[model samples]
Target: MFIFKLLVILTLGYWIMMLGDTLWARKLMRQLPASPKPGGSASTESFASAGLAQPRGTTAKELPLVSVIIAAKEEEASITETVKHLLNQTYPRFEIIAVNDRSQDGTGHKLEELRKWSQGKRQVEVPLTIIHVTTLPAGWLGKNHALYQGFLQARGQVILFTDADVLFQPHALADAVHYMKETEADHLTLTPKIVVNSFWLSAFVQYFFFALSLYIRPWRANIDSQHKHGMGVGAFNMITRQAYDRIGTHQAFAFRPDDDLQLGMRVKQAGLRQRLASGRTQLAVEWYKSLREAVQGLEKNIFSGFQYRVLPAAAGVIGQLLLFFFPFVAIFVLDGWVFWSYVLSIVLMLSVYSLLIQSLIGKIGKELLVFPATVCLLSYIVTRSVWLTLRQGGIHWRGTFYVLEQLKKMKR
Candidate 1:
């Protein structure tokens, strides 16, 4: 009985903290400028219109050249389309470099097809360059190594690292670059609209984002006073060549599965400026085909998010159980103020979730009904990741088995 009361108190306290975080996150989201509508004055929008201080000229010729680097392995399904979207970008001074990271599938052949097609079509404004990597060297992850290879071939002043599966609107890069220049950010990352068809999967993605918002506190990164706060997203991570080189480049965290996040961390640690923006309208990606795929896909980075430590991973699972699961169970089994306390905790949880939905999607829907189940699924994922890492002695990613000891030594 005593333990139950203690649990209720702890759960209530957790929700209270979450309330403050959700509200702050809401404020930050409100301050973020929306991406320009497609085919609606996107080509003519300037820094002055955004009310941000312009560092220099805003003409097409004056803008820094942007080199987009996409590291792909077994990405044949979307590489062609992704490159096609890049070719349509309104940003005049830019190039697309697609690195075929020793892909065993049709990725290389598809890229070659795209290259020939672009040449035949005379799309020289944004030349498409393809680098086929026959092998991955020692002490490097596949994607990171692939990105480094693309970087070596990049000639633009600004570089954008994106995944092969991401889709971009015609004005995505133009708007993003304009925002970065206006804000004078050394590194910029944009959040994509995750397209998940399954109701449960969508719920899980929402819960994941909510948890990330609380854990990383990305809103703090925008505040000039908060130097240590930073954020990154794989869908779109844009950085200047100077800032990229200053942070020691991708080689700094070669073995890390969460390379995108480590890059943001490096930028912050180096005292370079970083900012995150909502790109829901400008960028999108089908995160995973199904829930089963999501579980398998997250295995690589879920444990890494805990720094590959057993204690922290276990604590994360236990914390989720207490905060998300226990309250509902206690509400029905207990009586008196303790019951009411659990009920209030549930209400707070729902309130925090509502704010997150409103901020990210601009509406509240039925996702809240699945939140509890998704929380349980997420906890299982964390447990499975830790267990597999320990039992198999390593993690399997991109057809390579990375030893646990080596990974821990190289953790960021």
Candidate 2:
């Protein structure tokens, strides 16, 4: 009986923390000022003149070159379309380097085809390069090794690391370059509109982004703060040459499979400015084909993202469950005054969640009803993810197993 009472009290306390966290997340979301217009000026303008020009009928001058590096491992299914998207960018001065990291499939062949296609097209102005990573360097993660090879061959002022599963709008480069120039951001990452084909996929993706907004307060993440250690999705990230050098490039985080997060941390450590943009207009990425892929993909990063700290990761999962599930459970289970209290909690939580959902939907063109379902599904994903991380120690990706070490050793 004592233990039962303690459990109830603990659950109530957890619910209160979740309520506060939800409110805090809402406040943080509100704190993120509206993004500047595509070419608007910020307080810093030393680099503003280098911003991308409006697409008018002017002969292409020597614009700052952009090097787009895609690291692929057996991505024959999607590499061709990804290359096509990058090659078709409105930004004239750019290069697309597709690094085939020893793909068993026809990824190398497809890259060759893309290279030939680009060379043959008189209309396509930007250069194209294909680098086949025959061997990965010791201590270097496969994707990072490919990116390193691409960097060595690239002569661009800005380097973009993107996945082979992404499709970009023509103006993506232009908008990103312009924003980078205006903000003088060393590393710029945009949250893409995740394309989901199935109902479960849609639910998972929606909730994933929603929960991310709560945990990784974008405004706070952008600036340099003590509590600002967070992760970046490597699907689409832009880094300037200077910032890349300052952070020691991929070499700094050679062994880390969670390269994006490590890179973001390095940038923060170097005191370089970073920015996270809403890429609804510019970028779209398909993360996983099925639920299994999604789970595995998340498991790989969940531990690494937390720097291999089991306690924090577990806490995060528990907190997420309470936040997402408490309201519904309260609605069904509570009575009288307890029911009213539950109702108040649910209303507050839902109001905040609804705002975030509406904002995301307005940007990404997703249905409104998807948000509720996502909340429940995300809770399950988080719980399962925690279990997998604790049991397996890491996740498998692209035929490579990323082994998770103890939290203390993760910094190495």
Candidate 3:
């Protein structure tokens, strides 16, 4: 009974912290407005006259050119459509730079095809440029190297590094650019909608997103008092050219699989102005085709997110089991106050998920039902990633096997 009481106290304390964090994040999220509609009044110049958040080092009369850089490897499945959507963006002055990163599939051919197709469009002031990388240079991850290559050829004052599979609504860039201009943000990351095809996928992705958001406290990055919090998502990471250079560029984390998050860390460490906006209304990406695919896709970076360490990963897994899974099981076995405590934890967890799902999907539906199952899958993903990396003594990414020793050395 005493042990159960102690467990109850510990679990209650954990839930209270989780609740506080969730509420605070939700409060911050509520402060940001939704992405402006394409033909809406929220043009790039809308906030200019208000001077609420002026573009740094520039007059409000002219819009700065933005270079959208996409790094592609085996992305033929979605590359064409991705570029098509980008071409339709309502943002006035921006260029698209696509780097074909030595793809074994039709990705390179498709990019060239898109380049030709974009030429006939009247809206495009700058034509789509394609760089075909035929070889992988030593000591570099494919995606990171490809993005850096794109950066080298970019001419925009603002640079946006995004994935090949992400789809953008026409006003997406306009909304993002306006937000950055208004806030004078040096680095801005827009949260994209994760398109989940199946019911289980929705649950897993939503729960995973919730857990990650809680851990990172992305909104806290905006607070001047809290100097350490920062984040970047792969779908949309936009930064000024100057800020990018200040953070040592991609070369600082050249070999990291989790380059997006590393970029955010560098920005925070440098004391650059960083912000997060809810772009779910404008940006969407089908992260993985299915649960099996999701597991395989996460294998490359899940362990790397922990800096490829054992204890942290193990602790993470154990922590998830206790905080996420234990409540469901304990609720059934315990009685009286202990059982109610577990119930309260579940309630707190669901409340957070409900708020998060509403933000991501525009409405909260029934994805919360599979919460326990999603928890299990998340735990499984972390364990599988760690085990495979350790047992194979390396990670095979983008058809290349990187030795563990080499990866560890690059962690610095």
Candidate 4:
């Protein structure tokens, strides 16, 4: 009972911290410039007046070629929509490089169809290069290898690396370029708006984004250089070619599961500016189908983040239980003011979670009020993930079995 109380108290404290962080982030975002879509009501002069003009060193006549590269492996479910959205982007003088990494589905065929159809009736051609990566090198991860191939093929002043599932708005690329130029950022990553179609997906997404928001706190990424860390989202990483050349591109992050993060970190460590922002309304991605799928997908990231250490992974499970689940368990064991206080904390927790969810995704159902239950659910998922990783001896991502020992060494 004492332990439970302590847990509840700790959770409440964490929530208070998260609340402050959220408010600060909101304030920072409000101060930042908003990138208007081309043909929108906001004129170029208005953007300049709003302090959201194009990069200081460049004009419309000298716009650089931006290459958008996607690495796909068995992403047939959403690749079409993703590629189509890229084709619809308002950003001019850009090319799409979609690499199909030995897909078992029709992803390659779909890319071919889009490329050919767009090329057949275009004035200056669709400018989409569909590369087929049939061989995965002995030591490289499939996705990383495909990305390296795309990087080798790209010939642009800017590179946009993204996932095959992410859908960009008509002005997504345009806005990103503008932001990059304005900040003179070598690397800029925008967190996508997660769209959930099912109840379970919504719950999982809530937990995921809440954890990410608490951890990342995007607002402070550029401001706090003392921490000296940076993050990149696969949905949107706009990197100048100079930074890529300086940091060795995907080769710098090859064989790592968290390629985006490591890449961003490398850019910052190299004294290159790395900016982060929310693409809440400008971009969207349905990350996973269900909690099970999410857990399956999280194997690499969890272990990689933990440096393949079983002890730390187990501790994470314990932390999740205490931080998220204990308040509910405390109810049955306590009484009077103590219990009521715990209940109040629970209300605070749920309210914070609901607000975060509403802002990040959409509305939540009454069924989701049982927020503490999700903690217990996530505890199980995380525990199972650790056990599965140890049992299988490593992570099996995209038909490749990466050994645990090797993953641990990757930390160095």
Candidate 5:
């Protein structure tokens, strides 16, 4: 009985701490300036005045060369579409370097087809280099190693590292470059609109982002600020040659599974300016196909992404539960004045969550009805994360086993 009371006290304490942190973070987000629009007047002027000449009225300029590097492994289904999207970019001076990372399927043949198509259509004026890495290097993650090899073969002034599943909008490259120049940012990362068709999948993505926004406002804060911490989806990130060199590129985070987050941290540590752009307008990525895939996908990085620090991650999960389920739980679990108190807390939490979701949905032109479902969806993800941490050793992704023991070893 004594132990049970102690456990309850600890849980309640954790809940309060999480709530306080969320409120503080939301307050900070409110105080920050709004995120800049893609290819806006200010962005264009900033880039143009920074020595990169802007294309004259839709006639795209002969801008500095850009190499779009895509690292793929067994991505036969989506590789063709990704390649086609890159080839169709409105930007004139750019090349596509698709690294086939030991794909056992038709990924290699598809790349050859893309090459043949580009040659026939005269779609590619710049060089296109496709390198196949036969073996994985030591102390390096597969994606990072593939990207590093791509970098070695690239001759572009800007190197854009993207995943094989991403479909780019025609103007994405041009707009991204303009924004990079305007912001004087060394690294530019964006959160792509994760496409989800299944009921559970949609809920997972929605709640994930909603909970994230409450704690970390990636879009509003500068990358180098200590108070700023956000996930940089590596699916769509652009880095200048100079900035890449300054931060030592992928080699700096070779062993880290969550290379994007590690790279961002390194950039911050090096005191370089980075910006998070809105990819909701220009980029889309399908994260997973099914619920099991989604669960495994998130598991691989959830623990490691937190640097194997369980306390904060645990607290984060609990906070999310309180924020999302507190209202529903309160109406049934409490009585009299206590019930009303819980009701007010729920109202406050829901109101804040709803406002954030509505604003984001309006900005992206997505359906507003998906907002309420975010709570239910997030609750599942949080629960799954906890279960994965306790029951399973780790998460699986792309046939690789990332266990907690391995993560702890990597930390050393």
Candidate 6:
């Protein structure tokens, strides 16, 4: 019982500080200007009407060219829509390069068709190039390899790496370019808006983001003093061609599962400027269709985030159990004074949890109500992620089975 009390005291103190952090993060997120539909908002509107928006003091001719690259393995469901959105981007001095990475589905055919249409019809003002990879070499991960190929062929001053499933509003690229120039960032990643199809699953993503905010503190990415902490997003990652080359490019993170995140970390380590922004209006993606899929998607992340080690992963699970569920577990098992202490702790926890839910309302949208009830479900997902990763000995993504030993060697 004394042990429980000491743990509770520590947890409460930690969470109280976390509660303050979450609130500050919420305000920072709220301050981010949401890009509304073309001509809907004052700060953000149609690219056609606004013309090419250059940096505050720069002229139109001085704007840099931005190249957008997308790598897809089997993204037939969303690739068509995503490509269309990319072609219609408001950023005038930009090109799009879409890579069909050894896809078995109709994705390869679809990209070729899009390329031919763009060439013949002159539907898009910029050049659209497509590449199809036939094989994966032993040293490289498929998506990273695809991106590197695109980078090699990219001719723009700025290179954008994004997922094939992410949908961009007409002004998304323009907004990113403006932000990058304004902040003078060498690398920038914007968090995509959650396209909520499953209420509970979307809630978990929102809750997870807010929970991670306590540690990641993404809003501070642009602060010069907080350069040690870096943040990234797969939906949108824009970096200067020079920075990409300086950081060792794709070869730096050849086989890592958390490649996007590692890229951000590398950039920070190189003493470069990096920033993170919200894409609530400009960018969005259907992350998962169902709760089960969400669970499966996180399998590699939990373990990879912990460096594929066991003790740290186990500590994370145990920490979650004690920090969030201990009071409930003790309420039924304890007696008298200890029981009342447990009850008080549960009330305090609920309050902080409630604050986290409110902070994420803008992120998940419409399905925000499902968050407060999904804490236990999220915990189970974490435990299961650790279990699946250790049980399988390594990750199996797409068709390749990355042996643990090979990965550890590559990581070295």
Point to the candidate with the largest lDDT: 1
TM-score of each: 0.93, 0.81, 0.91, 0.87, 0.79, 0.88
Candidate 1 all-Cα RMSD = 3.3
Cα-based lDDT at residue 332, candidate 3: 88
TM-score ranking from best to worst? 1, 3, 6, 4, 2, 5
Summarize candidate 5's per-residue lDDT along 1-412 as a digit string, tens digits. Answer: 4543343344445445555655554443321122333243553554343333464343234466789999999999999999888877766678889999878888888888877877777536656678888887666667888889999999899889999999987767767777777678777777676777787666556556667665645544453565335345687778789878887888877767777766666666667777765576678888888767876667556666456776777776666556455546656855665566555565555455555554443232243345446565555555566567657775554555556666566652
1-412: candidate 4 lDDT, tens digit per residue: 6765676677777877767666556554422245753332333433343233453444344667888999999888788889888887766668999999989899999889888778776543438999999988866778888988998899889999999999887778777777787778888888777876777667766786676656555555575363467777888888988888898877766778888887877887787887877787778888887667786777545667666777877887787776667778877888876688777777776766766666555556764765666667666766777888889888888877888777776664
Error of 2 at 371 (Å): 6.5
Instruction: Tell me the deviation in Å of residue 144 in model 1.
Output: 0.4
Q: How do the residues 16-63 of candidate 1 rate in per-residue lDDT, one tens digit apiece? A: 998987787766663236444332244435543333232443445667
Range of the 10 consecutive residues with the lowest summed lDDT in candidate 3: 31-40
For candidate 3, the TM-score is: 0.91
* Candidate 3 local lDDT, residue 405: 86
- Over 4 Å off, model 3: 30-61
Q: lDDT, candidate 5, residue 100? A: 92
- Which is the better candidate, 1 or 3, if ranked by TM-score? 1
Clashing pairs in 3: 53-182
Ranking by lDDT: 1, 3, 6, 4, 2, 5
User: Compared with the true structure, what per-residue lDDT tens digits does model 2 show for residues 175-249?
Assistant: 887677767777888777677788777667666766776676554555455534644668777899988998898
Best by TM-score: 1
